[model samples]
Target: MMRTTTNSEITKGIVLKAMPYKENDQLVTIYTYEFGKLTIRARGSRKLTSKNAPSLLSITQGEYEITLHNGLSTLIRGTAIDYYQNIKKTIEAEIIANYLLEYFYRYEEENKPSLEHYQFLAGILEALDIGYDYRIIYAYINCFIMKENGVELMMDGCVVCGNHHVDAFSLESGGFVCHEHMHLNDLRLPKEQLQAIRYLYKCPIERLNELHLADIGPIQKIFEYYVDEFCGVNLRSRKFVKSIL
Candidate 1:
């Protein structure tokens, strides 16, 4: 059996990257406003004085309509609705955005589009569209990792030995520890930071802007523990981001 392709138009997405191709063309990966993720070729976009070049290269945000034909997708044209140079100017925004791209490409299952993940990225991008806030940004990402991995860490009580006066959180046990289960080497979080993390797990994304972290250091540490132990691979860019920040 033979399959044939059809041409169509798609009005969605934000350009994620513009990579060189041959002599005069470029390849673009867009986080589509409609389809989630898409790739398209922009023919002759590298030529000097080409009108589409600037727009295509600068199409960092907003929706776009692409032309498709004969199994080829091209950025025939698009208009910029909202854009900010803050992402490029601020190291925090840049790293966060790149981390997002890496996370999506690494974990997002193909042919399986999740509106939560898409919406989460969109929300974080909106937050980054403004000035950089390192702690807030990292917290936003840390909580997402938990949901993405389905690791519902018990925040209120110890997973190994339930205790009301829990002090230290144990990565191995999935939550805080009672005095009996607490190890001398286990990380202990201050009361306020522990509460901050608990609220983050329960907080809805829409209301996250109102949530405040008493301390991002411990939450970030806790998040790293989970990613290292469970997710199995640490983001290489994480180090770079920490260095620059």
Candidate 2:
């Protein structure tokens, strides 16, 4: 059989999800530095003798050779980059890592490359691999993702009145609100929690390791509310991570 080499490109990417396809193939969803998110079919990847099988695992980073044909892209070859092996050492870490992948997969658009966002995801995965506190990493990554997407919470003041003294966060209003403007359903966030969010908003992604918060529950709730109301994503992996925590 003669092989055609048209439309082939090589890129670095991380596998977000890989599922069995047909008899001896795998369908992979990858987030790449050169191209945002892509769904590529891996031919003959299910067989034990396949060389590309190991690199297709979820959260595995690698370089991929992809060929596009008939509007569908197929991964022709792959080389393992960073498996982040430490992240798979424990169930909790795995769940959190999976949640991160799911969150990005749900929100990021296909074929629109944002190098900053790509680097942010890569940095967070590296942090996870190096044994950072999962909760802190989760909160920071959520905030960074939201910020990158331009839907980050307004921490400067009340979204409605611009008041600096905020008593609660109104998910419907999309920001913090003063006591006078607070809705009945708004979540009452403590001053410390508000300050923490403010810091996260301005903090650099690489400097996230230096931050320490005694309680992350409030911040996590804020992020969840933002994701649900704005991004319209309900991540099952997020729920699973919470259950085991």
Candidate 3:
């Protein structure tokens, strides 16, 4: 049998991170919408005269022309379509965004991964681009955890008692519960806030802010604990993010 090269066109992607290599070469990890996340090294992108330096630093919702040869992909040319101007200036957003990027880079399979997760990376970038709410970012992370892992969280009723229009929540049991089930290790989730989380999980970008969260700390902590301790996603960046704030 003989070997042949395969080439294809990909939709668009964001540069998650880039590292300098050799004298004037660089390696970049990109989270793409159509193809999930993958790494493509630029031949000569480390020097001042190189064109890719700007693109490497230009992450967050940036779209580009990714050329794939055989089983390898390279950034032939790229342009920053959505720069996410203030994502860096805002420390909290930057930390959370970078943490999300780290998760994508660390967990996503190079060749095969869920494409929706890739789209999520772009969506989060867009969300951060528009505003600087850390709570919103946290909500997105929780929703991402559920969506990516194929875990369905039923928020309508208690896992133990089948209560509807519930007011409290339990991470252990999944979601909302009635007063009789308060001893089931579920946290007290207010109705309005549970509605906000529900909205976050299902609503589109335009309607995310409709449910104004007075305080997302408790909810965020609950999901974070569940994600890190129970679900086994221990991101060092998450630790760092916690240490700072």
Candidate 4:
């Protein structure tokens, strides 16, 4: 048997992050539509004259040529498709976009292709670039992440009594609770806000442009608490977004 270093392939992907490897090299993590997540090494990408540098930035979508090896793949070359310059130019959108990129980077498994995840990432980036409300996008993605992890919040009726009228979101019950069943500390959620959250979870990412919620803070907090309690992972980027809001 012989080992080969020329197992090369081409794929379309978005750069999640890039870290300096050697003095003039980089290790780039990319989530591809075809191959899921890949870490490719780019030699001399740190130099100002490097052609591969522009296509390697975070959130840049491009077509890449990679020489796959057993340990780490090497980047042969790439061409940029979308820079998402609109997202990079706006600070708030940039933060939320980074948060999204970090979220996927942390949760998405390597070499496991998920068209759903890839499409969701690509759609959200496009929506953000188009100047949709970042808060609504964040709220929507929170529900998405929670649902994908099997910790989806029960939004239809009270998790306790099945009552149509719900008041507060009870972390203990993992869903809405009527006034009779709500704990002393449960946060009271208004009917409109409750409906909004339900809509967010069910709404397609592409249709987000047609909807808007003036205040997403309350709903966002509910999903955040749900994720923290059930998922057991807290993202630091979430806190950064919270601080500025």
Candidate 5:
């Protein structure tokens, strides 16, 4: 008996990263709109004359035609759609763009299809290319990922008492705390900052221009810490991003 494999199909996605593989090949991880994350082997992509080499670069969004197999998929060819060159031209945008790619590469499961995740990532990358504030975009990404992973901090009301009048944010408690329920040492943020976080969770990336935070540092730090503490994964690129900021 012989096994039958899936036929070749085209997927549109951004190349999260490509690792050099055995002599002249590369293993490319792509987050696709139809098939979620996929690791495809690109034979001869490392060579200078390889036509697929340009399309396989990190952060390049394109259509990839691949033939699926039981073990691993092979990339037949790719056509570049957008290079997002503007992001590569700026240092801050570039670092944040890499961080965004790293986030999806770390969290998204391979072969699980999710249109929502795909669109969200695409929008973020587009925003970076258009010169949006990287700090705010980074914070937004952190907020969205935490919520998707079921570790989102509550901002609507008190996590403990359900009081609408909250005075502080508690990392341990996992959300805002009402003054009545607040611990003595609970971190206090201005009321505006609290509102900013609430908006961060619900607002789409395209509407990011409307959101203004006088100082995004504190809230951004909170989201980063929340992810580190609750999600239980240390992003390797996070330190470099932080240093440059």
Candidate 6:
């Protein structure tokens, strides 16, 4: 049996990660705006003379020409797009960017395109490039990712009893629980923290800078637990970012 090759398609994407393939080739995982995540082999990408070399680095945003052959996509050409030069200048920014990229790479199913997810990711990178508060940016992106994946936190009320005056969050229950229904191990979030989580869910990312978040520690912990418990994603970049902070 012979598999016919598809015509080359062009897309805009960011390189999530790049690894050395056989000899001069490079295996790159990219999150494209039009086609979602793809693992494509870039032939001779490591060579000095290769035109695609610059756009093959992890975190580089570029236009890619890909052709599907025998169930594998190969990179025919790449033109550098943003490169996000500002984000690469600082270690903290780089770590945060890497963590976000790694999170997407781990959870996003390949070839399932979501324009919302793509725009959310691209906007986050742009935010990081322009030097917004990274912690808030991280929390915002996490909220968007969770929402897009349909695991958004149940913030309306108690997940168990439908109580509007919820006071605790339960990792086991996957959302907020009323004081009466709260288990012994459930996290008791302060009133402000609960409000903050709700705001993150409702507010747009562009308005993130307007928020006067006193502390995001509790909010971060809640979402981190949610993603770990539900998605089973354990990102190395997450640990690294935490260690430095």
Q: Write the per-residue lDDT of candidate 3 for residues 3-97, one digit (tens) a residue.
A: 22355454577888888777777778887766666677777777787765666774556566677644557776666666677787777778888
Compute each candidate's TM-score over C-alphas: 0.82, 0.84, 0.86, 0.91, 0.92, 0.84
Q: What shift in Å separates residue 48 of candidate 6 from its native position after superposition?
A: 1.7
Record all residue pairs in model 1 with backbone atoms less than 3 Å apart, i.e. clashing: 13-32, 13-33
**Per-residue C-alpha lDDT of model 4 across residues 69-91, encoded as one tens digit per residue:** 66688999988999999999988
Better of 1 and 4 by TM-score: 4
Candidate 2, position 67, lDDT: 86
Q: Write the per-residue lDDT of candidate 5 for residues 61-142, one digit (tens) a residue.
A: 9999988765678999998999999999988888988888998898788888788888888898899999888888889888
Per-residue alpha-carbon lDDT of candidate 2 for residues 1-245, written as tens digits (9 for 90 to 100): 11225768888999998888999998898998887788899999999999998889888999999985434589989999998999998677787888889977877877777788788788888988887778877777667656655685677899998999898878787778999999889988778887787777778766777777788888887876666666656778877878865
- State each model's C-alpha RMSD to the native: 3.5, 3.9, 3.1, 2.7, 2.6, 3.2
Judged by lDDT against the true structure, how good is candidate 6?
0.82
Instruction: Provide the global lDDT of candidate 3 against the true structure.
Output: 0.70
Q: Would you list the rank order by TM-score, best first?
A: 5, 4, 3, 6, 2, 1
- Of the candidates shown, which would achieve the greatest TM-score relative to the real structure? 5
Instruction: Report the lDDT tens digits of candidate 6 across residue range 1-245.
Output: 22225788888999999989999999899998878888899999999999999998877899999995555689999999988888899777788889889877887888877788788788888888988888877777677657656686677899998899999888787778998999999989888888788888788777777767778888887777666666656778887778755
The list of candidate 3 runs beyond 4 A from truth reads 1-11, 70-72, 113-115, 243-245
Which of the numbered candidates is closest to the native, going by highest lDDT?
5
**Candidate 1 ranges with C-alpha deviation above 4 Å:** 1-7, 54-59, 67-72, 161-165
The backbone clash count of each candidate, in order, is 2, 0, 1, 0, 0, 0
Predicted structure 5, TM vs. truth: 0.92
Q: Write the per-residue lDDT of candidate 1 for residues 114-135, one digit (tens) a residue.
A: 5666677766776777653656
Model 4 worst lDDT window (10 residues): 1-10
Q: List candidate 6 segments past 4 Å from native.
A: 1-6, 148-150, 158-188
lDDT of each: 0.67, 0.81, 0.70, 0.84, 0.85, 0.82
